[model samples]
Target chain A: MSATRDLVGVAWTGLMARKVRTLLILLGPIIGVASMVGAVGLTESAKGALQVQLATLGTNLIIAQAGGTFGSQNPTLPGDAVRRVDSVSSVTSAAATTNLSGVISVPVQGASTYYEAFPVPVRAADDSLPSVLQVRLIDGRWLDSADRVLHLRSVVLGSGIAKQYGYLPGETRTIRLNNTNFGVVGVLGKVPLDPTLDNAAFVTQWAAQHVFDTNGKPNELYIRTKDGTTAATATVLATAINLGGPDQVSTQVPSNVLAAQAQANKTLQKVALFAGLLVLTVGGLGIANVMSISVIQRSSEIGIRRAVGHSRSKIGAQFLLESLFVGVLGGVLGALIGIAVVYLVSSLEHWVVEIGYGQIPIWMGLALLVSVIAGLYPSIRAARLEPLETLRLG
Target chain B: MSTQDPADPGPSPDPGDPTVQLPTATGLAGPAVQPLLELEGVSRVYGEEVEIYALSDVSLQIMPGEFMSIVGPSGSGKSTMLGLLGVLDLPTSGTVRIAGQDVSALDDPKRSRLRGQSIGFVFQQFHLIPHLSALGNVETALLYRDIRPRERRQRAFEALDQLGLGARADHRPVQMSGGEQQRVALARAIVTEPLMILADEPTGALDSANAAHVLEIFAGLGTPERAVVMVTHDPTVADTALRKVSMRDGRIVADERRVA
Candidate 1:
């Protein structure tokens, strides 16, 4: 029948009376909850970043290339491979490219003091490569079908190669390819998915067939499927590209790799949550330990309270209240620490900070549960003490 | 153990001991009044295998306004008798009544409620909770009484101030002297203004000066509406009470009433 407020006050004072022990008890929940929260936060943030990347570049990209090993005759992609892949109902766009022999060098103007220029790889690329690969133009036009059909000496420079040759779009800047001059049609932006393209020089089939004397067959085929059809398109892309020798073509879907990464993240998050709960359980045990010690150490106080008209049950309730208060405090601290961890890690990794704010209350409730469970035995023990005996002992 | 031999019949009550012969409620009180507390043939036993009689067939009555003491050497069972009188323990084979209610028959909560409403206890060690301020410790007695918090605090402060501890009400037990702590304990016991105040070796832990001060306070605590019972082994401490009941071999051997 004690006033609940008074009992709570007593519990509060009891916890405040032993600051160091209380802090030690708080540590378990704090770290446990923090790690759990941080794990979920980091995973979520990474996933969020992945979504943005996927949304812009699309998850339906497929890379198909010749399947021969080194020192063997490398099977070539059919000259009609792009058209064949594009013709598939699920395929959105298709393009192909092949690395041509000999590097392209930017011919230096006389008296220019620029450091020695790095030779750029020259690749025979389709006119549709820019749009299918999601590569934006930083300067001028990409090679068109007209250039390819008319055998024009038009070439495109990636951003790195453009900067090397000091070529601007619309300027008649030319680069040396097969000892013949080719006009730079445009400079492509940096491609995050494929950094090697940043230093490559792209030429249409006109340059490949006329100057290099190479067949117009592409070595690599890039295919884009409609949304939700990448996996299904991947199964048939090899056969669709080279029907006669589907085994000679190897098709890889980059989106599947991303999906695997996401799956791994989900698994890691589960493990983190489990670890967090385990730590929370340990913290709860710590609370019980401290409560037990408090009961024993405060036996005399218990006797005093009993003599002052506190019933046995009231005594138990007081101890339970103390532990509950400690638990709640630990939960709050743990949650705050957890959020801070998430933010800290997310910021360090330059990822979007994503936190499931709704889970905080649940986590705190867990702490309370742990505390009550831990405090039960000690509180009962406190209640069971004989008033007279405890008074004598005290 | 030799001094406590049940066969010795040592130190019988003198012929002038009126209260010793007046054991019944009628003899202790007028026809219209009931004794505040009464014990009828109470015996408390311990041990299941071998019985030990901590208190034996002892009967006594305490009237309001009585300042009394139960004194005995070790193993005389005065502590056991005190426990029964305070309603803290149930007797093995007798009725213990407080304010006309049978304490032994009541369950734990009911008995505890009765005890809380009727009796307050003071200990020799001045058992003030160390973490709480003097006011908080005193307030412990008034809790579970359905009193408003503001009123409870007011009453607790008044009790502390009554015991000349007003200036130290905010101080913790560790910050107080032995005398101050005992005074705080006294404040706690009287904060609820119960029918009886029970003290167990109240001054055993104090110096002579503090003991005298605490005894003086005890001497002034009993009133026409309240009784004060002191249990102690010290002769000087027992002498402070107006009525002295001495026990031996778990039996009341003497009951002497003195005129102040």
Candidate 2:
């Protein structure tokens, strides 16, 4: 152990004797490692953010819309489409949704005016609307099958609509759509991702058909698959539904979109990884060049040491240790700088910092390995130096 | 006589002189004291197509307590002889024995160990490591030894003090005068207390006063258990030794013991 420590001390002294050259040699690896770490951190955080956004749109939900001419309004789905999709083996439940523009009146508490009229968007949906859209009810009750059978004029208000009209659960507010009035029975909590749902009122499909003449049709069908159903099953269902309506229906599975996005992100990660390795290879070359010069410059000292009884292997080990020290020092400095860069950029972009701490050891290990490989030739060259020849030159 | 084989082992030409005696196969004519260093018919050749003979048919011996000087002009193979004696290079065809061990048969690492344990060297340039302090430079001599760190430092300090550089122990080579640096190199050389000390122009870079001081130190180092071999071109420096060997064209022409 003492022998090893002595060799390490000698190596350290040799490096300290040439501080400027050492720092200059370290610069290349420092920049390379820093950029590599920073790129990995940035890519990971971006992927995390994308995953969060994808999660907001439930993975199991698939939206099927009527595919019509681009400029024209999308054609509505047949009235029985919801029941037909719900009956599919892979689909757990389905809901049909339609939207109409309407006017609503809310009673004023302290004014002489009897009511105030405001434009409100209205949606027609079934009892399974909350399950299909992943929505929660703040108060009151949703429209059930009995209401549709009885043709009761009942409505549910979104949080935004409720706030705007000062409507509460059990409130007898009438909303007029195409000169027909419906009673509000429930208020929904905010649906952040679906802004249209947050600012609209909802009623049963039967009431919507009777009141607004939708002809028993809906703008879109929302299907929730069984727990184990894959995205391919959703496509199969959409194909079955559009069997007689060619070029008139479109299918969208959020999980499939997310999978495609993840695949592209993987390719991008691989490219970035290749770039980082290329930079590191360049840095390794720089290390090799500097180490070669160091060996040449210190040939006389090596000869002297050999004459003083140090073996050639000891001399080789000393140079190898010096280069290893540079590698470790550069790795440590680069990791800190990379982390700092990652944090700064992430904060600026309001992204969650997602650096993998586990990767740090692996990266440092790789840097050290590269440095050792780079130093091998120089160390061997130093060891092979004939003391007689070197001292003669000196 | 010129065409006769050099390895005939017969009396050399001009054998009438009694002061110079060629070494025989039975080794030096003394049985009581073993020679500290011995080279028998040593020859060193270098290069391929156009071979160069650095040292040819050189045979010599030095017993303990001998202060000998090898004096020669340029290209007389003084450096090559020193390298062979120092175990830094093996002779092309001959035997080198140090303290009765055949060193020419040892491998590189074994030879290094033998050099570390049995020999010390002082170069003409005072080859002290420039970055290390005088004490640190001396300590390097014991680095390959099994000495503890504290003992190594203490011995190095004592060595420096003996060289009259106790106060300059902390000074680096660049901060010291040439003479002081040479003394530091001398201290490094003697720190190991080896069987022999080899000085290659030890005082070549010193002034007359510093040179005298270094020669006094060298003269004082030759105890009954140790020997010293110095190579020099300065006749005045060579005259300080108890015995002198003169070389011409890679062969020793004369070996004379002076009345001290």
Candidate 3:
């Protein structure tokens, strides 16, 4: 028999002789591998993009809101809930907010009697609320502990309310709430995670209890934990906020949603990979059909080769080598097409591009294995042909 | 015909006869000068229910340094005889030997190896692979052998040059004329330098000029170390060989040697 290199050359020449037929046969494997590669790359790129967004959105943030159940018509956290939560081991920061009982109206300009046209709710926030929520102020400084100690009656207007009143930091405008005049301290920007806060006005909890007759009980507690500790912090946060009755509060860690989304993405990847493999099997069948037809068409060539000196196994090897060439070429082309698709889709969607370049060899190996299996029958049939009969027939 | 028919031509001494076992070309010169191929009482049969003997009790000896032809009309078993002589088929009832080894005793791979190393075939239709160039077609004979690519290419070029086809080595079969294609097939046959060349109607598809040229090349190919056997139906083509064996009804009717 000839050396494998020579056989490869012969096989290559045979394939090149029928360029159109070979390319048509290659189409199946190319599309199959392309779908598989594209699916993996796009999912990975999407996961990378999600991770970036989650990192910026703060994975360690936990929110505990008082919820009413069957036993209680109204549920409220303990008055010292933020203090208790701040004492937890992993808690980096804690804040609380509670709305006042009655609606507060901003007086219309040049009107003696208040029309109550814009009844923006006034929320009482702790001194650390701005830091825990990680909100940036468009103008002026955040409310501090000294504002509560001195009862300065300072108010920070949310972005939506500030825009409505044309309020800016250090402006001479005084907002009157419940017949008490409060100086504007800051104007908050948009809060993407919590849009409800974008329409409310904030004041210190101490000032709310003293001037606005609030019950001094927090309705919601926002806690920031150490990095990678959100899940652990959430487990103990409800009990920490309502020790007497932990069921009165519900804890939510937004990072868990990201984890669930990752799990869903993993499932989608498996399903897509299975679909790609199904198409690959069909492609392999296509190769088998082409190879079989090639064997039939080249029977005379087989006869000549046999008469010349080729053993049956050598003839089989030559045919298999041709099939392997198809597989490897298709794999390379498919991988390139898949990478291009991933980059195109990722760029259009503004996602991070992540390709598994390391898996390319494995994909090629898979194609080789598939083609070898597909070509087995045809090669063996070519080998089993009777030299005399084929020669006479040809 | 009976096995002991008196019509057997005995003018040339049989190499297997005891009297010729001395220091001569047909003697024990370390087995090199023995008959290149010998078939003793070889018979091929077909059909299970109704037996059909393609060849029955056919005994023949083909010596080295011989240029001979087997000529017969269709259905006279000449093709079957060629198959047995080329080691492409085994007999049903008797032994066929090539270079002192029994043909039927070898396995498929061994038989194929022996055929490849000892016998070369030229077909009637000039069955050159159309995709390969003339040189490439010649190299195919040596592909299954142990020769490296450089030497193989060199040898193929030499064979094509010997066929007066040196300038057309790069032409594919489809691009060449019928005569050139036949010459390329001849190059492929002789490239391996086998012990025997078996040509089946070598010039059947060629014009008179190409046929004469091919016959001339065949004449020069027979040497003391090799044998050339041609199977043809044309009496004119058979006349060119030094020895001619004529067959009819599955039996050798005449074995004649031309006066040199």
Candidate 4:
């Protein structure tokens, strides 16, 4: 133990004797570890945000849309497609909706004489739309089966449209669309995953078929699978709905999209890790170079120690410990700086900062190992020096 | 004390036998008075293609309590002889024995251990680690020993104090004069209480005053269980020893006993 303490003292003194050189040698590893931590933290936070967003969107939901070109002339899903999807064993609920683009006009607030028109996307959805889309009604009740059966001219305005038109729930307003006036019944809050949904208008399927002449067909279908089923159920539903074959319809599962996104993130992380390793390699080389130079400069001191009966291995261990010390110091400083950088970025982006605290040991361990490896050659060189020759040279 | 008297020489003992004891005129005979160091037909050759015999067919012996000096001009292989005696290098074709143990056959680590246990070295240049304190430098001699830190420090302190540098224990080599640095080196050398002390031109860099002081210190370290061997080129320093050996062309030409 005393020998070890003496070795550490001697190594530390050697480093402290040349302050500028030691500091310069330390910079490489410090920068390498700091950037590595920062990159890892940044990637982790992004992945966390993505996971939260996916959870908010509900993983069980899948979207099926008419395949091929999308335009006014393209054929959409038949009216019975929703019924066909609902009949699938794995599907719990399904809703079909057709989108239409039109202009809407409303009287200026507190100035009934003036009118303003804005282009808006309109969605015609069944009574099951709320459950399938997981949308929340902020102002009034959602559409019921009676509203669809009665073919009532009722509409729900998205929050953005409501704010634009100065419309409120229970306040009857005429929304002119395709030369027909529809009465507004409710307004929806912002949807978590789909930002575009906040600018759309919603109406019943019967009203859309009668007023817009959509022929009881829908361009989009939203489905909720049973508790354990996933995108595979979408394939089954697609095959059942599109009796014609695979090319006639398309299916999408949000979880699958998230999986692809996570895969891309993994690739990015691997690249970042490679870059980090490259930087660390440069840092390791710097340590090796410094240790080599130290060995040469301290050759006489080494001879003195050897003459006093220090073994070659002891001399080697002293230099190795010096390099290891530098590496550990760099690791600590880099970790702090990296965490700070992560915090600053997370704060600016309003992301939940996640710095896997468990990885701290691994990072430091890696740094130490790298330093040992870097110091190996130089330490061996120092140990191979002949005490007689060194003393004679001096 | 007696000066040199030409006594009849005894038969040489077999070099390979560890039990053999050679006769000496010191009156302290038997196994207890055995020579502390011995070299038998030692030779050291350097360079591969162009051979150079740094030391050739050299043989010498020093008993306990003996203060001996090896005086030679340059190229007389004094340094090479010192290296072999200190176990810093092995003789190419001969045996070196310290305290009755054959050292040339030992491995590097064992050789180092033997040197640490039995031999102390004082160089001409006072090779003290520049960054370590005087006490720290002295303590380094016992770093590999099985001693505790507190004891190591205490012993090192005592060694420094004995050299009259107790108050300067915390000073670095750069902060001390040449004589003080050499004293610290001496303190380091003696901290282990080795059987033999080897001084290689110890006062080569000192003035006459400092040299005399160092010689006085060396004179005070002689004991029945310990020996001091100094290699020097200065005849004035050589005269301070009780016995002296002059070397020429890697061979001892004169062995004289001035004081006994």
| Chain B: TM-scores of all predictions | 0.87, 0.87, 0.87, 0.87
- Writing each residue's lDDT as its tens digit, candidate 2 over B1-260 gives 12234576344463321211223212433667778899999999999888899889999998888899999998899999988888888999999998778987777777777787677889888888887889999998888555557867988999999989999999999999988998998898888777789999988888989899899999998877678989999889999999999998899999989888
Q: Pick the winner on DockQ between candidates 1 and 2.
A: 1
User: 1 or 2: which has the higher lDDT?
Assistant: 1
Q: Cα miss at B197, model 2 (Å)?
A: 1.2
Question: Which TM-score value belongs to model 1?
Answer: 0.82
Q: What digit string (tens of lDDT, one per residue) describes model 3 on residues B1-260?
A: 11222575443443231211112343435744677789899898978999988888888899888999999998888988888888777899888988788989988777877787778899998888878899999998887555557867988999999889999999999999998899899998888777789999999999999899889999999878678999999999999998999988778889999875
> Once superposed on the true structure, which residue ranges of model 3 sit more than 4 Å away at CA?
A68-74, A99-123, A134-213, A243-247, A264-267, A356-363, B1-32
TM-score against native, each model: 0.82, 0.76, 0.84, 0.82
Report the C-alpha lDDT of model 1 over B82-173, residue by residue, as the tens digit. Answer: 78888778899999988778987787777777777678898888888888899999988877765557867988999999999999999999
Q: lDDT by residue for model 1 over A1-394, one digit each (tens)?
A: 3368778877888889889998998887777777777778878887777666766877878888888556656457878888888889999888888878554455554422232254467888887888888978998889998887777888888888788777766787866675678887788887655656788889888778778888878888888888899888988887888887643788888766665554427788899999999998988888888888888899999988887778988899889998888778888888888888878877888877888889888888888888889999999999999987888821
Q: Which lDDT tens digits does candidate 3 get at residues A71-141?
A: 87446688888889988999999888897757474633443254255468788888777778787888887
Alpha-carbon lDDT of model 3: 0.81
Interface RMSD for candidates 1 onward, in order:
2.4, 2.2, 2.3, 2.1
Better of 2 and 4 by lDDT: 4
- Please tell me which predicted candidate would have the highest TM-score against the true structure: 3
Off by over 4 Å in 1: A43-48, A62-93, A99-122, A137-187, A190-201, A219-252, A262-278, A358-363, B1-30
Ranking by DockQ: 4, 3, 1, 2
